[model samples]
Target: MKFISVTTADGLKIIINLTKKIWPVAYGKILTMAQLDYMIDKFYNETALLELIDKGHVFYLAQDDNNNYVGFVSYELNSEPNKTKIHKIYVLPETQGTGLGRQFFELVKEKAIENHQKAIFLNVNKYNNAIHFYTKLGFTKVKDEVIDIGNGYVMDDYVMEVDILQ
Candidate 1:
């Protein structure tokens, strides 16, 4: 797989829609439809995504030899010192168990370290099975909390952090 930085608004749209596809596949069994819909509309909207890109966040779309986009990951350095947060990571259903997610995550780790980030953090829905995936990739659960995402909805997440510099 070849991973490339997204350079156009059209590319961003492809990433957002891919995000939608993976969200349902990864989160639907854990979250209610209403909750999932709220997240998709709030975060995957073009304007919202553009704002993220404008804020110095990095977005990557992974493609195969045929140029078929199969996965994506996005991350940003926040105000917190020495830390980078991975906002989203997803691989298509057909590629989930094929090591693509691991490759994408390693790319995220490289990007974080290149920026001098010592650690990386992300929140995973408690009911999702991806915790094992993260754990296998060296993330340790630091805390569990309910994040209220407004509109009477809340996400019960396990906040996991990985020490990339280690």
Candidate 2:
């Protein structure tokens, strides 16, 4: 597998396309259709993604040996020094158990450490099965949060963190 840093218009478009393919299947049971649509529009839109990139968010496209995009991860440094926040990580449903997620996460950790980040954190839906995956990857729940993202939807999540400095 390979991780490509997304920095161009084509790269952004690839991620957008990958998101459209990954989200519905990944979040289908975890979120209502309304919430899924709203979140997709709010986060995966071209403008939103470009804005995030402009703000220093780094996106990586994960591809297989055949060069097929299989997953993606996005993260950024936080206001607090030595901390990195994982903004997004998703793998296609078909690729879930093939270690793609773990590979992507390892890449994130490598990048974080390279940037001098001591810890990495992310928000996971309370009911999402990925919490178990994160736990297995050395992340522990730090706090619970309920974020109102408008449109009558709220993200009930657990903030998870892993101290990479260990």
Candidate 3:
């Protein structure tokens, strides 16, 4: 698969739609539909995505040889010293066990290195097995926090970092 940058407004909507589909499938069992819907509306709205895109955040579409979008991710400069933050990463549930996520991270890591970032960091849901995947990619847990997502809902996440300069 190849990664393409999101360049059109419609492209961002497609990404968000895919994200909405994947979110419930991925987290519905772990979270209530009410919670999931709330978070989706609160975070994935067009305005929010447009803001990120405008700020030059990197958003990638993982496309097949035929150019079908199979997955996507978003990231941006981290406020921490010499680090880049992976804001979101998702692969379609139907496409998940195919090593696409690994390839996706490899591409992101290469980009980080090219930008001279010493490390990369990401936040994963506390209940998700993605920690195993991230660990396999050399990410080590650095901290854990509950981030408020408006209302009374919050996301419990494990913050992990991989040192590319090591």
Better of 1 and 2 by TM-score: 2
- Going through the candidates in the order shown, the clash numbers are 0, 0, 0
What lDDT, from 0 to 1, does candidate 1 have?
0.87
In candidate 1, position 146 carries an lDDT of: 96
Give a tens-digit lDDT track for model 1, residues 1-166: 8998985789888988798788887887888899999989998888888898888788899998888999998888762688988888889998888998899888878877888888989989898888999999999999998989999999899999988765
Residue 162 of candidate 3: its Cα lDDT? 90
RMSD of each: 1.4, 1.2, 1.3
For model 1 the local lDDT of residue 107 reads 88
Candidate 1, pairs of clashing residues: none
Tens digits of per-residue lDDT for model 3, 1-166 = 8788886788788898888889988997788889999989877888888888788678889888887788898888654777888888999998998999988888878888888889989989999988999999899999998998877888999999999964
The best candidate in terms of lDDT:
2
Q: Scored by CA lDDT, what does every candidate get?
A: 0.87, 0.89, 0.86
Question: Using lDDT as the measure, what is the rank order of every candidate, best first?
Answer: 2, 1, 3
- Report the lDDT tens digits of candidate 2 across residue range 1-166: 8889997778888888888898888789899988998998898878888999999999999989988998889999863588899899989888889998888888888888888889999999999999999999999999999999998899999999999974
Clashing pairs in 2: none
Regions more than 4 Å wrong, model 3: none
Can you rank all candidates by TM-score, best first?
A: 2, 3, 1
